[model samples]
Target: MMIKKLFALFLMLLWPSLSMAQTETITHGSLAIDRAVMRAALPGSKVTAAYMTITNNGAEADRLIGVEFSGAKKSEIHSMEMDGGVMKMRPVTGGLEIKPGESVTLEQGGLHLMFMGLTERPADGETRTLTLIFQKSGSLTITLPVKMMMGGHKTSS
Candidate 1:
């Protein structure tokens, strides 16, 4: 038993890349989060937005219940809409429901996660880990890479 434990530890150290890849791709049950990203807020900005594509591969629906990350006092799922001629934003009280075999995209100008009271802006090339909890899929954690938001940039990653 001791030799088995040592062998396991040796394998982990021998293949560090495998561990990193596993951390980046988080899968819980039948749900998957793809292309998760958070933009660096402008200087002195206290809030920032994060976007991702959530796919429900299971036979039943799932709800995204919560979000968490470092350097954030609070995080909530929000939806942006144009009410009349003005834009409005609101938090999703219950959760965001994802139907089976459907994909919900949280991107700019739409549904996204708002990180409030950030300690510092996410710098370019910086990586942060985000934990997303679901009603049925449990917790899905991924490494969120900070990138510059572009006018024409697409969220196809």
Candidate 2:
């Protein structure tokens, strides 16, 4: 199915990070979030991004409804697509869906977290707490350690 293939592609892109950060996964009931990291940004920069993998372990689907952080003036779930060799990014209109027993990855050049109007620049090697609201799980808070890059330590072009 198309959904299966898309999920598989996400998994493949996330495979390297998963293999390297096996111990970094955080689980609650039927949900798990892995390798959640925020990219480093220069001061005065208006935007930054975060990446992670979210998994549902139960026999029911869930949706990631919202993301919150005090450091940014605005936080949004964004998706990126390549159009004729051009990369375009935009906010995801609806919430991101997660299937039962399935994992969804948010990474560079795809579905990701976008932070704008940062109150303060994200610091490297430091941790910031991010609250994720799920359709079924209500809210789950996790520490997002600020890092220069993610997923095999590769930076975006």
Candidate 3:
């Protein structure tokens, strides 16, 4: 009798979940930050760099408007371009464009975020919270892990 009672209780608990249908979540577009960190900058330096990858899984295109960080006085989008056989980095005033079903990679020698007037250097094994504001997706909060000066994976505070 006890066994039957337990089985009945289990069935009752499972009924609700089985009856409820699951629906797929449709994200018009999404961005994933692979890894972001700040390089060692001189004291009172006016510039630093951040690298990451922006991915769009949805069917529509998206735009990354700006980024905000606590340790930096100013954050701007920048890209590296070839000028007269020389690599020159410049600020992208219009922001970075992400096409539909595509991913824009911001690696070390290409596109990156320019962090100016860093209030303090992000030490190794520390985590920094950065907010990325998008043209349509509003804002996304990401915790970037601080690595060693030599680069590679460390840990986020």
Candidate 4:
């Protein structure tokens, strides 16, 4: 009985780290992609968004040309802007550029990945795969965790 109680206490102490979402970094050539996360899709919602940071570690510049995700029928790099007191979202044309030794962050209310026609709605704690195609770095595949947005912050569900 004492051993069982101690084991339970140990698990309780380790629960937070076990339940927290883990951030993963994937690299290809001189490009490193990190902090990749997708928002949990609400019920009956066919669209969702993802965000990440891409860093260029080499001397040459590169462009993010395309994205691939099997869970969605279409994926595009998008940007949101306020135009004359109105918010507008549009697809980024000609790809996004990343200069040498610079990091480009795709985040909410700015640049992000727009996934439309979702074949599967992502739930909290789910892991999804995303393939990023770059102009110079080629293709890099990264795994992203689906996190719930609560009060403008990400939380594990």
Task: Choose the strongest candidate by lDDT.
Answer: 4
lDDT of 3 by residue, 1-157 (tens): 9999999999997764464323211122365555456555544455567777777876777788899988888888888887999877778887788887787888667788777777787765777777888887778876666654543211121
Better of 1 and 2 by TM-score: 1
Report lDDT (Cα) of residue 70, candidate 4.
Answer: 98
Every model's TM-score: 0.79, 0.78, 0.70, 0.80
By descending TM-score, how would the candidates be arranged? 4, 1, 2, 3
Candidate 2 vs 3: which has more TM-score:
2
TM-score of 1: 0.79
Separate clash counts for every candidate:
0, 0, 1, 0
- Estimate the Cα RMSD of every predicted model relative to the unseen true structure: 5.5, 11.8, 9.2, 10.2
Regions of model 4 farther than 4 Å from truth = 1-23, 150-157
Q: Give one digit per residue, the lDDT tens place, for model 1 in 35-126.
A: 78898776777878889988898999999989987878988999988899976788998999999999999988889998888887787789
What local lDDT score does residue 131 receive in model 1, on the 0 to 100 scale?
87
In candidate 2, what are the lDDT values of residues 1-157, reduced to their tens digit?
9999999999997885676466888876689888899988765676788889999999999888889988888998888887899777778877899999789999877898888778877878888889888888889988878987644322333
Q: Which 10-residue window in model 4 sums to the lowest lDDT?
A: 148-157
Worst 10 residues of 3 by lDDT: 20-29
| lDDT per model vs. reference | 0.81, 0.82, 0.69, 0.84
